[model samples]
Target: MHVPDGFINAPVSAAAGVVAAGAVAVSLRGARKELDERTAPLAGLVAAFVFAVQMLNFPVAAGTSGHLLGGALAAILVGPYTGVLCIAVVLLMQGVLFADGGLTALGVNITDMAVVTVVVAYALFRGLVLVLPRKRGSVTVASFVAALVSVPAAAIAFTAIYAIGGTTDVPLGKVFTAMAGVHVLIGIGEAVITMLTVGAVIAVRPDLVHGARGLSAPLKLRVNGELVDAAPAAAPAATPVAARSPKKIWISGVVTALLLAGFVSFYASASPDGLEKVAADQGIDAKAEPHAAADSPLADYGVKDISDARLSGGLAGVIGVGATLAVGSGAFWAVRRRRHTDAGARA
Candidate 1:
């Protein structure tokens, strides 16, 4: 959920800002290990994809809707550290460009949505993958469970933060109950989206899916009436020209993201999302302040002075996808460059 300004006090918000900064710093270092030639570009694509999918909010309850949080999906496709950065990029873009989230409360949103969700989902996903059969399907299953849990975990995190710095005097129990309850329903949608996205990527390019790496069991051979592990296969003398290029998958992913955001987003549910609904019902928005960028041309996911709702929204969505891709790719490529620099220095 995107926490708007005025929901949390200045002190707590600043504290959360420090925490967010520290987490991002740590992720930048950690992402060095996760990013390279193959994954660095895909990381940006994953961010754009998440941004696109989040535009399509699905109905969860009669008046409540939910959208992909993208932590589990991103973490499964890329890696945990990169996943956090992906979400941070999306949140930043939404806040500054679309006025979807508040600028003052950026830290709170990053902490609750980006850091908490990625940490919880990736940890749970790895744990589940360890215990389950080491198969492609198991990665999909783990992605589902990890995503399902991450939504409520983020809700709990929000409730805890609100208890400490909530602007209103709403009862803590009511806030917790409402946030947790609605988000559980929302979690199912998150699970399904994460599962399908991870499954699709693993099917096409398991090597590109960080969570699915090493999932294929070692080849076995029958010898002396018993199956034995086959000797490791030697590396091929020459890499297949077709196998070396992820251009096809990358192009396909970009096209899919464009379609989802540019056109399909128009059909998404118009109802308020889980957090907005809970805030309105629980009186959590009593002190909510207007977004600083409310007057931006692209504010509210529509182009300024555009009378046609469909065209304005479509253009805004396209712009958002493009901006996110650009910013995210730049950030990830920098990280990748730093990784190579470090290696060169060491050598």
Candidate 2:
């Protein structure tokens, strides 16, 4: 959920900002090992795709809706550290460009949505992968479960944060109950989206999916009543024809993101999302302030002075996707370059 300004007091918000900054710093360092020539650009595409899918909010309850949080999906596709950065990029774009989230509460949104979700989802996913059968399907199953849990975990985290620095005097129990209850329903949507996305990627290019890697257990030979690891397979003379290029996947992803955001988003439910509904019902927005970028041309996912709702929203969505891709790609490319620089220095 994107926390808006004035929901949390200044001191607590500032503290959360520090925490968010520290987490981003740590993720940048960790991402060095995760990013490389092939996956770095793919990570950017993942971020843009998450940005697009988040626009298509599905109805959860009569008046409540939910959307993909993307932590589990990103983590399963790429890596955990990179997943956090992906979400951070999306949140930043939404806040500054679309005014979907508040600028003042950026830290709260990043900490709760980006850091907490990624950390919880990836940890649970890895744990489940270890216990389950090491198969491609197992990764999808683990992704579903991990995404399901991460939503409520983020809700709990928000509730805890509100208990400490809530602007209003709403009862802690009521806030917790409402947030947890609605988010659980929302979690199912998150799980399904995560499962389908991860499954699709695994089916096409399992090597590109970080969590699906090593799914095919190494061959072992039984010799003298003991099983020993078989000799490694030799490299082929040419790449297999079935193997898809990263460029193809990248282009396909961009097209899918554009379609989802540009047109499909128009059909998405217009109802408020889980957090907005809960906030309105629970009085969490009593002190909510207006977004700083409310007057931006692209604010509210619409182009300024555009009378046609469909065209305005479509153009805004396209712009958002393009901007997210550029910013995310630049950030990841820098991380990749830094990694190479470090290696060269060591050499």
Candidate 3:
């Protein structure tokens, strides 16, 4: 849910900005350890994928729709720290280029959508994976549950933030109920999307999926007082096959993302999202401010002066994907480079 400007007062928004900045700083440091040659490039692709999927809003209720919040999917595919950066990059691109999320409320959006969701979802995912059977299916199940919970968690977070800095006089209890209720439905959509995407990645390149790393290569077990490998004897012969280059998957994923955004997005439900529906119903948006980039060529996910709805939206989506990929890849590359440099200095 992208909080627009004026929904929260200046003081609280500024505080959120500080919190968002701090979280990003922390994530960047943590991501140094999370990203390597293999995963760093994939992080950018993850961001672009998230951006693309978010545009395909599925209807949740009569007048409400929801899209992928993407915290769980990103964290499961990459690392939690890198997931935060991926989402943050998408939010930045949406705010500045697409004029979708509010510029002034960017911090609040990031805190609720990126920081809170990633932390909660990843923690739950890790916890479940530990207790469940160590298999690919377990990862998929954990992803579904984590993503299901993360949406409401984010809704609760937004309610908390609104309680502190709400611009309207709406009853806090009603706001909480409405926000949570609608978001719960939205959570189902998020869970489904996250599960499908996570499952797809795990099937192709489990190695690239940070959460699925050890699941494919089963651990040895001691049977009848003797230690034995869990895998069958012939399994060792498949090493070369499984060791295929990631380039194919990477390119295919990017192409799929482009297709989803540039073409498939045209048919997405047009209903207002969970947050927007709640804001309108609860009067939370009574004082909502116009976006600063309202006149931008790509405002409202359409190219300016483009008469064809399909062409306008398609062009905007493509631009968004391209921009998110560039920014996200550049940021991750920098982090990866710094990590190598630091390692060298230590050595």
Which is the leading candidate under TM-score? 2
Where is model 2 more than 4 Å wrong at Cα?
240-244
lDDT value, candidate 2, whole model? 0.93
Q: Residue 90 deviation, candidate 1, in Å?
A: 0.4
* TM-scores for the candidates: 0.97, 0.97, 0.95
Cα deviation at 120, candidate 2, in Å, is 0.4
The best-first sequence of candidates by lDDT reads 1, 2, 3
- RMSD to the true structure for each prediction, in A, is 1.6, 1.4, 2.1
lDDT of prediction 1 = 0.94
lDDT of 3 by residue, 1-347 (tens): 99999999999999999999999999999999999988988999999999999999999999999999998899888899999999999999999988888899999999999999999999999999999998999999999999999999999999999999999999999999999999999999999999998899888878788988766554689999988778655544445543577777878889999999999999999999999999998899999999999999999999999999999999999999999989999999999999999999999
Instruction: Supply the global lDDT for candidate 3.
Output: 0.93
Worst 10 residues of 1 by lDDT: 239-248
Model 2 reaches what TM-score against the true structure? 0.97
Give candidate 1 regions above 4 Å deviation: 220-228, 234-239
Q: Model 2, 308-334: lDDT tens per residue?
A: 999999999999999999999999999
Give the range where candidate 3 is weakest over 10 consecutive residues by summed lDDT: 233-242
Please tell me which model should have the higher TM-score, number 2 or number 3: 2
